[model samples]
Target: MNHMLLTVRQDANLTDNLVGVNAMEVLINALIKSGAQRSSLRAKAFGGARMVDGLSDIGEANAQFTLDFLESEGITCDGHSFGGTNARNIRFWPATGRVLQRMSTDRLIEPKTIVQAPPEGNDLELF
Candidate 1:
């Protein structure tokens, strides 16, 4: 079977708009609808970097959200590289659930220490 690759981008702000399509709910649903199974699916999560200076903890929130969502769905996240100042490029093979995470240093940005925000209402937007 051909492997499927999913890439989720980074959102600097934890907003309601960031949910929905970007949430793991949608990802898993899409995979299942396409005949992917949780037991057979392995996830490679990436790209939660604090890119902008003096910003809040959006990157960390995104990483946590991903973990929580996966855990809730009983999906195994076999690989992950998150919560860093540098951006990362990742590739995931859905067939075997193998993931490759690579960090980028060519265009690195300095991260600023910021406080995390409180979890608000249901930010997950299901499709």
Candidate 2:
């Protein structure tokens, strides 16, 4: 029941054609070298939470880039989780192709109580 699962972030510019060590091309090559057939390859992508406020949604952009890349490369994307304000924690099991995603939730933290020591008994009467 041993399998290899790879998770990596793509370059900000996917069209640049730069093959970085962690780039998709390298990942596919590594899989091939490890005896996986390209035709049978499948992917499950996660993350891309919109964590900021601005004109550009970087998270959505990255997620879209991944889908586009996989599509262009003829790879099947098994599933995806995308586009949310909350952060996400993803756990993927390659052998089972199972993905567990947990979204960030707001929780109120109770403040700790600070105890102050009483003044020393009359050691220094003068202030």
Candidate 3:
């Protein structure tokens, strides 16, 4: 029962680096190298809040991309909270596949959201 969390935040590097398409590969490889069985691997992604106005909504793009990547790899997406005007806090238990989320924009002043990913299925809950 091993789990992995990929926080897909908008990065300045994503615009020019392989991160735009290879980020998921990196995460999967890291887990494999860490002795995690591919069959037992699962993903719960977070982050990618539209934290700013007048800028591209990279957060949403990153979050959706992450979920799409997981689906393509046949990994179960237990939970996620992506693309919102509010920033979020995600707490995940990799050993148990349990996740908690809270979205708040009142305390912060930025807005962001993430990508164009085709979704295969949906089971994530937003908070």
Best of the candidates, TM-score: 3
TM-score of 3: 0.68
Ranking by TM-score: 3, 2, 1
Supply every candidate's count of residue pairs whose N, Cα or C atoms clash at under 3 angstroms.
Answer: 0, 0, 16
Clashes, model 1: 0
Off by over 4 Å in 2: 1-11, 14-22, 106-127
lDDT of 1 by residue, 3-117 (tens): 3343435663456435633655676677778886657666666767777667675777667777776677566766677777776777666566677777878555566569999
Q: Which of the two candidates, 1 or 3, achieves a greater TM-score against the reference?
A: 3
> Which digits, one per residue and each the tens of the lDDT, describe model 2 over residues 1-127?
2233333333345453344224778888888898888888888877666565443556666777778778887888877877766666788777788878888894423346699987779676666
Q: What TM-score would every model get versus the actual structure?
A: 0.64, 0.67, 0.68
User: Which has the greatest lDDT?
Assistant: 3
**Candidate 3: how many backbone clashes?**
16
State how far residue 83 of model 1 sits from its true place (Å): 1.5
What residue runs in model 1 are displaced by over 4 Å at the alpha carbon?
A: 1-9, 12-22, 107-127
Cα displacement (Å) at residue 50, model 1: 0.8
Better of 2 and 3 by TM-score: 3
Candidate 3 residue lDDT tens string, 3-100: 98777776534462356557667777888999888998877778887676667877866776777777878898777767766777778777787888
Which residue pairs in candidate 1 collide?
A: none
Model 3: weakest 10-residue lDDT segment is 11-20
* CA lDDT, candidate 2, residue 110: 36
